[model samples]
Target: MKKFFTSLQTKLVISFLLLILVITGGTFLITNTQSKKALLDSTRDDMLQTVALVSTQFTAADLQTLSGFKAGDDGSPAYLSMIRRLRDMRSLSPNMVNFYIMSIAGNNISFVVDDAVSGPALVGDVYTDPDPRLFDAVAAPSVSDNFYTDAWGTFISAYAPLKDANGNTAFVVGGDMDASQVITRQNFIGTTIYYIMAGAILFAGFMIAIFSVTIIKDIKKLDKTADEISKGNTKVSVDVHRSDEIGDLADSFGRMVASLKIMMDMDEQPGDK
Candidate 1:
């Protein structure tokens, strides 16, 4: 076993195999990380686009519709019908969990929820715990902001404030859409593909190194050495028998033995150390 390990063929095979393993492992890690980043980036872009589309639908004219229902001056079946219609519009988008319109002037908010757990019961409630940024957005008459919450399966919550016909910040029309599944699935697929490719490359490299070093190269060297030995040189130097280091050492020992034999045959005196 020790001799086998010291042979050039064995050393070459081991070194090649180790190199292949490292390269393959590194490739897998890099691909995996890149894939994850790409997927998340894609999800973020999609969410952004969706939010922009939803916000665009909230205009000054739309705020007028909500304002009528908020003030008792326009309390009628038509106003109720309009609110229901707005809620229906919010529900039309499958990605959206809920849509809300907040009245910054009245400090009142109304919401329509598609998620059963966080449904419309929370609608028509006032927000006393006001965020200054949120208020500013509603005041801007077209303020858009993005928010995230892990509680509702990690959604990108967005709001775009709209002004009334009088150019006053009257309301914000915004919605929350779930991103957990979309983002998570992307991550999973990217990770899986990265690992698969990595494993395949590692396996292929290992096979190539093993076959080339231990089998192909070693066999060629062995055949060359055999031909040299067959030339019938007695007291052959093992070094000249092959091009490997092992062959060189063996040849040196062979030459030494040959010299010793010739000296003994000559009846040399034992004065030589």
Candidate 2:
């Protein structure tokens, strides 16, 4: 076992493996990073477009009615209608986890209508410490740059304003997607990269092993033939059959052996030939 590990073949195999690891690992990392960014950017655009499309379904009057209600009024007919409408709209896009409206008043953002369908937030509930991006959304459609943390944990989101009759911003409609979706996909990309890396290393090791063994085996044969010649044996032949450097060395050694036999014949006396 020790002899095998210390052999030239093993050393060459290890060297090639290291090179393959560095090159394949670098490319895998770069690809993983780019794939993650592209997935997030694409998801952000899709979510933004989702919220934008959903915003068009609501008029300012729908939000205007719900904007005045308090916590206990969450079960009101108008609010329930809004909830049903939001849920129906949400069903069309399963990736969208939730849809709601937040009325923007200076720095104060309050929930007007949210269709969570479970433990829903009440009307007129103030959003605690809202992200400043929500305010920007009141002017134009805007989305979070990536998955971001809020009172509800991390999620990718987009927001667009619902316009009133006077063309003023009534409320900002928002859409949400679970952060786990992005995480799951990123994990997938990393996993794929690792698989490819493993396969690449194995292939490199296999090829290097074949090459190293071929050269070493030929050299060993040459060494054995030389030892036989040193002991005065001239009938043994250098039997290597390759076209590479080792083949050339074998050819040269064979010629030397042949010339030695010719010289030995010439040196013989008539009776000693």
The lDDT leader among the candidates is 2
Tell me the lDDT of model 2 at 88.
94
42-100 per-residue lDDT for model 1 (tens digits): 65465445544655666666565555553342236655554565566656666666655
Clashes of each: 4, 0
- State TM-scores per candidate: 0.55, 0.88
Clashing residue pairs for model 1:
237-251, 238-251, 239-247, 239-251
Error of 1 at 169 (Å): 4.1
TM-score of 2: 0.88
Residue 159 accuracy (lDDT) in model 2: 94
lDDT for model 1:
0.55
Q: Which parts of model 1 have CA positions greater than 4 angstroms off?
A: 3-25, 59-61, 68-93, 103-118, 124-147, 166-169, 213-273
Whole-structure CA lDDT of model 2: 0.83
Q: Write the per-residue lDDT of candidate 2 for residues 64-138, one digit (tens) a residue.
A: 675676777788887788889999989998988889888888888889888996666678888886656778898
Model 2, residue 108: C-alpha shift (Å) = 2.0
